[model samples]
Target: MAELTTLARPYAKAVFDAAKDQDAIDLWDQALAFAAQVAANEQVKVILAKPGLAEQRKAQLLADCFEEQLPEALSNFLSILAENNRLALLPAISELFSLYRADLERTVKMQVSTAFEMTAEQQQKLIDALSRKLERKVELESSVDQSLIGGVVIRTGDLVIDASVRGKLAKMANAVGS
Candidate 1:
């Protein structure tokens, strides 16, 4: 939700800055992803909602949820979140942290869906084009969707290029119906 995003942004920025300074951006990204998954567990949700539970207990429960012990910096960050009663904001924090990391690294991830699998050459070409267009290094992930009928659909964040035959037919059908 918007409120959670607003609440999580500062924490994410703080994590990003800290990780960047330490040259541990990748490590922090992995840590946040794991923490976000832990915070999303149903049992954790129940515990986090318990008003009478102390902040330390909530933080401890979160730490215990992780498969392994958190690193010192991440543990300290989690403790701060617990102290602020913001342990529930981990998912939003992870999401915003990822965005900040991507921006810092000048990387953009894109998806290409088509009716048939693409050759490596074709995939590389798509990646090159997207890198040039977006002015960022592009990671192109390919998927086959028979329902696409033909051609492809490229999705990058909020932007979608619907070049698939299915998409074209749908547009034509809408035009004719109108």
Candidate 2:
């Protein structure tokens, strides 16, 4: 079997290209979300994997589920995946599509985990700081992790800034132990 990323890349690229051509990135985004939802449903997964089910029937099921809401291109893409028995790759395809969109938009998604919830002012401050550091627009997703004790941990793609109290304390403990 191919790796999930390998399986998803071509699908993502195809959707991205189609969306770019149509000037309907949002439409592709919606389709990817819907596809991911369908792929995640256990019943749908079972039906997709059923040995006796024909490809045409699977395509019909997908069409019936999404034909009204999805664009023709997206519907056709879904049907192609059904025909190819690759419906399970939808989640990864969605993720890859998001990455492609973010790249095109010059936006970065950052995850900021703090010991406590931050005020809007603080969140904006962090965003500003990240924008300066990364030199790009930052879209932050914030969460509270009480285990941090205090301070924030920022994760942007391959970079992670661990400024949490727990991390500092661990470093100090290691220094003392040494």
Candidate 3:
């Protein structure tokens, strides 16, 4: 996963830069997302993996899959990826592009896991507090995980706050074992 991300980073950065310059970040975001979905299809993967297929054909096939006409720059980008046999990196590239977009827009996506589901008010309070602390808009995605036992765990980018009963138990166990 990390290797895929590393390989995709340069492409994502270049795409993000181009989108920023053209004031088409949202458009590029949608395009990349759609491209990634298309690239992830089993049939598409089989076709893309064919050794005899020409790079331009592969690129054109991808572009044609889009319902909307792609911008010239995006078509060129697809050509470059096809030329380099990097179409498989589209998902990672799309994810990285989203991260870049979030940074540019001063927003952060956070994942919250709890043993029980969070109420609307609880989610709002958490988002409000995180926004105040991080000084950025907070987008919360929450899920209930019974294994958490109690409390909640929040994750955003590289940061994680584990406040669950299971987490505390594991910490104590590790400390005693150590």
| Candidate with best TM-score | 3
RMSD of each: 1.8, 2.2, 1.3
lDDT of 2: 0.87
Report the Cα lDDT for residue 123, model 3: 97
**Any residue pairs clashing in model 1, and if so which?**
none
Ranking by TM-score: 3, 1, 2
- The true-structure Cα RMSD of candidate 2 reads 2.2
lDDT of 1 by residue, 3-121 (tens): 99999999999999999999999999988898899888898889898999999888887888678777889889989999999999999999999999889889988889999999999
By TM-score, how accurate is candidate 3? 0.94
Candidate 1: segments with Cα more than 4 A from true spot: 66-69
User: What tens digits encode model 2's per-residue C-alpha lDDT throughout 48-132?
Assistant: 8888989768766866777576566776887888878888888889888989998899899999999999999999998999899
* Model 3 weakest lDDT span, ten residues long: 65-74
**Candidate lDDT (C-alpha), each:** 0.91, 0.87, 0.95
TM-score of each: 0.90, 0.89, 0.94
Q: Give the per-residue lDDT digits (tens) of candidate 3, residues 8-122.
A: 9999999999999999999999999999999999999899889999978999999999888888999999999988989889999999999999999999999999999889999
lDDT of 3 at 41: 96
